[model samples]
Target: MATLRKRNGRWQVQVRRQGFPIQSRSFRSKADANEWARLIERQQDRQELGPDRKALKSITLAHLVARYRDEIVPQKRGSAVETILLNRFLRYPICQKTLNDLTTADFAAYRDQRLKEPKHRSDKPVTPKSLKRELSPLSHMFRHAVVEWEIPLRNPLDGLKLRVVDNKRERRLLVGELDRLLESTKKGRNKLVAPIILFALETAMRRGEILTIQFRHVDFGRLSLVIPESKSGYSRVIPLTRRAVAILEALRLEDAKPTDLAFPITPIALRLQWDRLTARAGIDGLNFHDLRHEAISRLFELGLTVPEVASISGHRTLAQLMRYSHANQETVRTKLQGPETGESSHH
Candidate 1:
């Protein structure tokens, strides 16, 4: 049974069933109210009214995100970043909508808003790459809610296509650039910056991995470092070059504890020092992570197979390794100009 009444210049429709809880909604027009009541009655008759509908009516996207941040994000590798992104998502107007009320259009609107928003400390709008990162946690949260939390709703993010513009970097270190950068680091306040930059180039390790390295993880006898955990969530042994070994040996403190970090600086301090050092050196458009790209390219130039380079770089896929390996034009030209071999040379 259903009842339609006018309240405060609005049409209110209420549906009642023998076994289900009462359903009610307010609409601007009588026809809209009647339609909603009819739909609820039909759904009830078909026994399609599930607990998910009731639960969704009471739960907001903000609540879901908060639960996800508390229970799920902490276990992720990039939890810190995920937390920040999730917080931003919670502040959006879409978060006010209940899970059952959320639609694909809402997410599409959110995506458009994110694209139009300028990046912090920059005039440029947020890149698609950044939007993708922000969306990843939200998508996962929806999955967690539907599958794990038993929230009865389809993921609104599903089928919503993101127009991601590829901005994969191919920046490689130029000749004499590393030397000048290193010299500039020596003039800075932090003495560790030069060695950290050199180590990144030598070992091809990420900034986090480099900072997380401890004395106990290094095996000088084998000339390798055992990374217990990396961004890939797997442990890998990286072979140390002579220069890398020398740098580590020189920095090793006689009275240092086994658990003490080889590079004790925080990531923020490292970035600050790097900025100062680069500015002093007059280096532009170069990033510390670019050193990893430079190192990977050097590994390829040294005649190492793709799999072999992947082992050192901790890249799981060949495609990923290829993205980091940007061979310089000079190197490519040298290879092209090398002596011809086999039957072609005999002619």
Candidate 2:
């Protein structure tokens, strides 16, 4: 329903459908207002523009994941690996439930079930952080479907208490860990892992960034690598350190085809190779992402300010990088040392 009114010598229409609030707009003429009213009336006849209107039926989580994988993931930066992780971790039993049916109890149950899965029995259970990452695609899909596809949502995740993630627990390699890792990488199962390890150590780059590196993107003369699209949605110039430059020089002389990847490998294979490297290194529980933390930690230790470190690391926020800048007690205690203390052996 709509009614035309005159206000300040102009015509306006106030339109409403059942269960929906009235929507009013000013117009230059009564005809204009009447035209809008006619349009709303037509929609009302078809029950499309009324407050009683309902959105499309609720979709199962599995359906949403499939749609997201096909329509959304391809445009993302780490879509391939992210899709794999999401499917591997979030699929099966839980995916059968509709978005509205995904209660806090379901999330809690899923977390507990995932933590106890037999596949991870030999290793530490899936941490809350890993679980959260696996759930990210669901949140994204729900939000998109609500706004774009007009799917009515109760936001199944709303107010569900999430586990506190201790990012600090898993970031840096301890003393001798790096050296042992390097030695182990030499004997790693995959030939590609060794070069990848060397590059990661030198450049402090993310796994996807390193794997996506194209020879043409490397500016040898300038000793810079132009990352066209980083996680920050901006291009970053990775200025090579002398060690990094040396690695590049060696890679530049390799006999591979020009268009072939510098490290043509899947993340699953890389993870398997890392497992072998860690076993041989006599180390345990280190993920490849820790290499990024190691690089950022070294930068701060060498007196590079957070902003300076962010330049090479492609971190957009100091708050984010601060998590990786966790200096050990020795480093903190060393900072506290002064001439007044006369360089004591212990704090």
Candidate 3:
């Protein structure tokens, strides 16, 4: 079950547990070597080592990230976001490290290094909000590591505090910005992005959901689209507004097959086009996700209740939904005026 042998003038633990290659470093003391072999053998006897560290220590973070990207993230609506973060943030730094070598200090160092990087090869500093978003997936991965893989003792993220992200809610178009953006979308080389932008603003759906939508998922009669796998693994049916329906109707591909994707663009391509659109629109520091915020704010301005907004946005909690409904100081004063004057029933 366990064997200790002399190698390079030191005793090494060598054990083959149920076809696994269990080999460890050569220890200077024979007693230390024997104890490690015995403990591992006992864990093997209990069927714990075989399922836990047998392959986990050998598995590199790159390997696990690839598996996670293909097997897990594909099933969620946030796949595109996760993919971007993995590629730009986690993948390069940790890919070479084994799972066992991922210490909290290493993660902290990554966070610090990311924060210090000039944004997008420019001299601009990386924001705390962006850094927080990058760290979000790692927390989930470590959770999966502990619960699913049975990695023993301590989550790397247990006590670490991430900076609070201060998000500026994008409410609506400012003056002629929307018209300019629409014109740019139509005349620009990336024409396919127009319908996607329209759909995102109308439905309040994420970019990933828009990219992966299939014709079969649309229910024309019910005026709703079903997302079978969302970020939360909870399937949801989102009711389409008239504008959304119109956009979809115009987007219907000529000679389209039933199985065809609504938009035939990859996530990376869509983002590239979005970058062009934003650059043309003269918008700065706004992401594709800000469009969702714009839509939710529009919903609130249209006098939709919180539940009504949440139904379309897929916000699981009230707190999540509230983050999108930011009213300007002028609007807040106007909204408070009627109540202060005792002239309105609605508060």
Candidate 4:
């Protein structure tokens, strides 16, 4: 409906309709006001140039998330992680609201509230890194809705700069820390943790990639393993070190099929086991991902080139690969001595 009123000596026209955002404009004359209102209403009636509130009102954010989780997420390499994130998103208060009622403020509020709370019962508040992952699915879902599903609503997450991305972790294993962590893992019921941790440091493979390994992918003859599906959405063949090959050999079962997953634990169980092992080891400020950083740093220290490290780690960009290549002072000191001639070690 269009209402015309004379305010401040100019005719003001306001268009109000259900399932449409309220729009107002001022015109010099009532004739012009009527014409503009007619055009806007007609255009809106034909469903042009605005979000479709009717469709949005009927579809809740939760519904959209469910659809995206079911239809789109399954095709991705990180489907399990994304599916978990989407389900966690569905429990948010804003998900109960229809897309018509959701504004950018809703998402902003969620970020603030979510950041204040500790996720998964940890004492520390949610880090920007984890929050980025939580919001990633929503960002992609909104884009898919707009482009593929023909949903007329603009993404609320767009322009909301809640995430400070890529907070690089420089945590590396301290002197004798690897041995201590392995000893602690030996006490745990998950017997594979020690070897898995060893394999992780040796190969620089992500936890997901490590967990999904099949027997057929490991070539005992070549001393290499193929990560058929890496986190980068591509298959990469990383040459296993002698230690990594030995770990695989110890874990390989005679009766196991080629299709069996090397590590039968779910990601959640692995996380829980890691937490326990870390606590038992008296380690602080360590994460499972840090092993990859340690591995990549070791690879660089071993005189491997950037391209060589990227091939093993499956990092698509140099920036990302460089993030994990933090070299320590000890490494630099060792390198400056010219191939362990014992010149710098005399101190």
Candidate 5:
């Protein structure tokens, strides 16, 4: 479409087309301006003008997500889970919007709608924590597109406010639960699960971090293990208990090279075996991650300070570490009555 007008003694013409930015030109003669308008309109219709706008207008968020999944996700540490999140995101209605049409309001609506629904294939409610996890890879996708791929747009999630959520699980191992759990894994041909369970309880390392440890990262002379790569993307040395050291010494293969993973099992295999072991042990409502929480809390009970435990647990903030570390009533009462305490009276 073309609009003609006279401005300041110049014949001005503006041409508009669907899926393309409106363009205009001015000329001394109406004939010259009209010719220019027709040429621009033809170029716009053919998608031959304003390549950036044309590309933006043609592609949808779903397409970019697919590209990101294939090209980017494989390089990430959490690719398995992140791939699933991006694949599920591709099916969302918001993905149908073109780049030019995308806005924060679209994702705001998506965030609310997802929160109201049950989790996929389960009766559990969709939690804000789970939503935040899903959004993590999606958020990085936008950043990579803009910063690396030069997509010419701000991240839509930049200003979106997520609901406050506290999904911390304080479900520590109950009395005798660890023994039963250990005993159950003994029947399996794969012997590493028991020691892995012990190691997690001992060091508070995440499953991913535990699996990635190489024999070279251990310093037996110092009785400390170096987490070469952590979730925080830095190395930290965690002081080892005698029991933790003994567990590692037993597991170390005499023929093992420094680069070989200490625990040879894959993450998927570990997860499947964990579920089976817990069921066989008759342990209810216990997650593998709960071991890390138990370890952190026990460190505090042993009188380790906040910074000390945080370094071992890879927690960047004190508040984050505390959320995972919970003390039971009996434990708190015992601490109050310890020999170091002074006599107390009602205030």
Candidate 6:
């Protein structure tokens, strides 16, 4: 049953049932209030009043993001970085709207606004790759809300097209550049920078993987390192080259504990030292990650098959492995020209 009354020049409706909680709302006219009350009463009488429906009626996207950040983000591989990204998403206006009321158009509008917004630190327009990363958490949050939280609404991000372009990086190390970089690193504040760069080039290991290596995880006899934790959530063993082995051997301490970090440097410190080293070397546009690319390409040049390279690089698919395999143009040209056979043939 619903009771209708006039309160301060507005119509108020309150519906109460034997088993359902009292639901109330205010409307400008009595007819509107009656209509809303009838809808609620009808839903309740049909046994359709669920906790999910109640949550959908009251919870906002901001609340959902908060819940996801607390409950889900911590369990992820890069939780610290993800937490920061999620914090930025919480400040957007789209998060303020009720989840039930969110539509695909709202997400499309947010995507456009994000593409137009300049980065806070760089003051440059955010790239499509970055915007795609930012959208990942929101998309996952909506999926979680639907599957786990039992929210009765379609994900607004579903089937929404992103307007930004994705440009894949093809940067490779040039001849003589490596030597200059290594020489400059020897003069930098961090003496370990040179060896770290060399290790990355030799092993094709990521910065995080190299930094996180412990003494216990390394097998000097087998010349491989066991990555106990990785971004893919699977442990992999990376074979070490002679140069990589020599670098680790020189850094190994006789009295070092099993849990001691091999590199003994943080990612921030490595990045800072790298910047200084690159500037001193007069190198431009070469990121540390490019070393991995250079290494993978070198493996391919050495006649290693895709599966062989994938095993070493820990790449799950050949398609992903191909992204890192950038053969030098000169090398490709030489291969295309073929070996010089002095015998002249007349056709």
Q: Which candidate is the best by lDDT?
A: 4
After superposition, the stretches of candidate 3 with alpha carbons farther than 4 Å from their true spots are 1-102, 135-161, 166-171, 328-347
Rank by TM-score (best first): 4, 1, 6, 5, 2, 3
State the lDDT of candidate 1 residue by residue for 248-342, as single tens digits: 88899899888988999987779778878888888887888899888988888887888888889999987797675457456778778886564
Clashes of 2: 0
Candidate 3 lDDT over residue span 281-344, tens digit each: 8876667887888888888878788898888888889988767556444566787765575466
In candidate 3, position 346 carries an lDDT of: 75
Cα lDDT tens digits for candidate 6, 1-347: 89999999999999876435678999999999999999997786454774344556588889989999999999977677788899988888988988667789988888889889897544679777888888898888877766676454676787889766656677888889999998887787777888889889898888889999988998988998899877777889888887888998899888989999889987767877887788799998798988988888888888788888888888898789867555744677898988888875665
Task: Judging by TM-score, tell me the better candidate of 1 and 3.
Answer: 1
RMSD for each model, in Å, please? 9.4, 6.9, 7.9, 8.0, 7.6, 8.7
lDDT of 2 by residue, 20-55 (tens): 446789898899989988887766554465333222
Candidate 3, poorest ten consecutive residues by summed lDDT: 45-54
TM-score of each: 0.75, 0.73, 0.68, 0.78, 0.73, 0.74
* CA error at residue 150 for candidate 1, angstroms: 1.6
The whole-model C-alpha lDDT of candidate 3 against the native structure comes to: 0.74
Q: Name the candidate, 1 or 3, with the larger lDDT value.
A: 1
Of models 1 and 6, which has the larger lDDT? 1
Per-residue accuracy of model 5 over 1-347 as CA lDDT, tens digit each? 89999999999898765445668888999999989998986665454675356768777998999999999999989788788788888888999999878889999999999989897545778888889888988888888876577565557898899976676678888999999998898888789999999999999999999998888998887999998788889888889989888988898878978888889888878988888898789988898999988998888888778898888898988778767445645677876878663756656
Model 4 misplaced regions, further than 4 Å: 1-48, 163-165, 324-347
Give the Å shift of residue 336 in candidate 1.
4.9
**Which ranges in model 2 have alpha carbons more than 4 Å from their true place?**
1-59, 89-91, 98-105, 118-121, 253-260, 324-347
Per-residue lDDT over 1-347 for candidate 4, one digit per residue giving the tens place of the 0 to 100 score: 89999989999999976656778999999999999999998877556868656768899999999999999999987688789888888888888999989999998899889899986847889977778878888998998887677676777888787657765788889998898899998799988898889889999989988988988999989988887776656887888889888888788789989888887888878999999998999999899999998988888888788899898989888988766555744776766866655456555
Which ranges in model 5 have alpha carbons more than 4 Å from their true place? 1-53, 93-96, 103-109, 116-121, 158-161, 187-189, 324-347
